[model samples]
Target: MDARERLAELVQEKGGSLAGLSRMLGRNPSYLQQYITKHSPRKLEEDDRRKLASYFGVAEAELGAPKEKSYDANQEWVDVPRLAVDASAGPGAANSAESPFDSFRFSRKWLREQGLEPGQLSAIRVVGDSMEPLLREGDDLLVDKSDRPFRDGIFVVRLDENLLVKRLTSQGGGRFSLLSQNLSYPPIAVSAEDIELVGRVVWKSGRL
Candidate 1:
């Protein structure tokens, strides 16, 4: 059993298929498969290799450990915050476990792939059905505070110091109405002076 054999075992034990591993490393699964199957000793780009190593809970050198396929997925779960299943809370709570004071490091390429513009928006977790069908509960929403109000769409608003996400409806007479997508919830009317626009939803993503 050599390094390649060890890597294969690690991947399998960690519940990482070639495709899932590819996403973490930002590489093609087919290409990785060739190297893993053929002992081709293919070199990974520094960042991608680092990410893969991190995902595997091992150093780059250890990725080649001799074939003992014992790995724990729980080791990797620590970084992710526990998400609320329903819309009990707004996007404000999704990554709330994260320290606001801690600096965040993210791949710019990944952000672009998710249709997020850096510094223009903040990410929030949706926990309620106020905006449903269009934006489901447990979805991640990106809000761009700098985005000015234009046509009607979903937006996060702060009314009376409470944060909520709702559909913005522009009515005549300089008034706006916040309507919930779910019929079960009633609409809230706001005067132009009282409404504080937090940001508009630029994009959303969710895990199935």
Candidate 2:
């Protein structure tokens, strides 16, 4: 299709709106709409084109240049669903049973090196500071739902309808202590029957 059509497709692929992109680019909300739908400017200006391309992680040619090739054709990608729930690191957060709102694609080879299967993985945002210094608020975690055996590691647990992310330490007598990185919050003792292991937190991503 044409350049404008390609731009529209890229915005949709990124799960963003034209208005949002316009605002992100410091233009009026109608700027992208006018360019794509009205074609008032006929084509994107060089600077504007470069900005859009950079924001969308695409080549400038993909935005409008003729006889240009797309960059993703030869790339390997694996789509990981990002769930709408938050795994609280402190008290707890309400878990949402809804499906994913969006997804992120990672390199297939890289994921394999982590020994994780894309189908068995899901992502959730972390909330609270109990697990601070390692997992901060608003951090995203990749959980391995299949790894529910529960050894001594970080996990997402459901306790009394609240979802939590905490480090689990095995205690004798069929009990475990939910520990937090921050020393202010005391560890909580829980029986095996009192908590349900949701998944193991295999990876985390957020600001350093």
Candidate 3:
């Protein structure tokens, strides 16, 4: 297909409108529409094309370039939605709306090795220094919504309408202690009825 057709297909796949793509690219609202419908500029500029391709998580070749493979064909990908809210590692952060802002693709093979199901997984950002050393600020945690059995490990819990990421230690008798990696922060003890288990933290990723 032609560049216009390819661009239109990608925009639709991303659930983005031409006007929205135009604004994201710092162009007039009508810029993308005109380019897609009419032959005004004939094609997208190199920079605009690269930006749009990256935003849609697709190679430039797929968005109307020569028919060359830009990505590995043997690699399988699964898209995981990234929630907009932060699972605070220190003080609890209120997360009234659990909406997703973006998505990240992971290799299916790697996910299988980790025994992670893509459908039941979500990515949330960590916002505090309580779980430092292991999980630093700005770390992205992969949570398993299906694995909420209250085991003795790290988990994302909701208490008093706020979300927190803490290490759970089962003290028995429906009681547990939330431990933090940082010693300066004190552990919190709570009964089963007091806190709600959001999900278990299965994996984490952050910059070095």
State every prediction's TM-score relative to the real structure. 0.47, 0.62, 0.63
lDDT for each residue of candidate 2 in 16-134, tens digit (9 for 90 to 100): 47875675455677899999889978987776675565445555677875435333323476556677789999988876453455667777688779886554677899999999999
Whole-model alpha-carbon lDDT for candidate 2: 0.78
Considering lDDT, where higher is better, how would the candidates rank from best to worst? 3, 2, 1
Instruction: Give the Cα lDDT of each candidate.
Output: 0.57, 0.78, 0.78
Best by lDDT: 3
Q: Which ten residues in a row have the lowest lDDT in candidate 2?
A: 66-75
Estimate, for each residue in 9-125, the C-alpha lDDT of model 3 and write its tens digit. Answer: 866654547885676566778998899778777777776765565455466676554445343223488666687789999988997555456767888788779876554677899
Candidate 2 regions with alpha-carbon error over 4 angstroms? 1-75
* Model 1 misplaced regions, further than 4 Å: 1-117, 147-149
Q: How would the candidate models be sorted by TM-score, starting from the highest?
A: 3, 2, 1
lDDT of 1 by residue, 36-65 (tens): 786554654555544455445454555542
